[model samples]
Target: MAAAKIKKGDSVVVRSGKDKGRTGTVLQVMPKEGKVVVSGVNIAARHRKPTQVNPQGGIDRREAPLAISKIGLAVDGKPSRVRFETKDGKKVRVAVKSGETIDG
Candidate 1:
């Protein structure tokens, strides 16, 4: 496997979709599926009937998985491409816009 460009907890911006221009933290990364679940982005609502376990089950709203290609790493509230760079004998993700290191 190669190094992951995007990981959990990474702030990212939606590149193309209904939620384009929206920025959020990455909650999960499914490398095998090439999808990612981002907070406050790509939300999906499911209408369900009441279940025996619980009482009300009107509409369930939650973040939906988005294709990995539809997002870019965010830096300072802006979207930017990421590239790996070796510094101090360690690999780090750097934003192309400001050339700043991205926090994990």
Candidate 2:
């Protein structure tokens, strides 16, 4: 599998989906599956059975994983393209707009 340009904690914008143009921080990355879970995006409700952790389990709202290709990195509060480069000895992915490395 190709290395994902986006990683956990990186801010991203939904590119093409029902949640298009929405921006959120990446909560998790499933590199093997080529998907990512973004905060407050692609939310889904699940009927949960009452458990010890949640005695009043009812509707559980959670972020659903979206395909990585559906998201674009957010730079300067706007969706921007990214490119990978090696600055010094470290390989870094930099935002095309500001040329700043996206924090992992």
Question: Which one is best on TM-score?
Answer: 1
lDDT for model 1, please.
0.89
lDDT of 2 by residue, 1-104 (tens): 88678878888998898999999999999999999999999999999999999999899899999999899899877888788898787888989989888753
User: How high is the lDDT of residue 42 in model 1?
Assistant: 87
Candidate 1 accuracy as TM-score? 0.90
Off by over 4 Å in 1: none
Model 2, position 86, has a per-residue lDDT of 85
Task: Give the per-residue lDDT of model 1 (tens digit) for 35-92.
Answer: 9999999889999898897678799899989999999998888888899998888888
For model 1, state the Cα shift of residue 24 in Å: 0.6
TM-scores of the models, in the given order?
0.90, 0.84
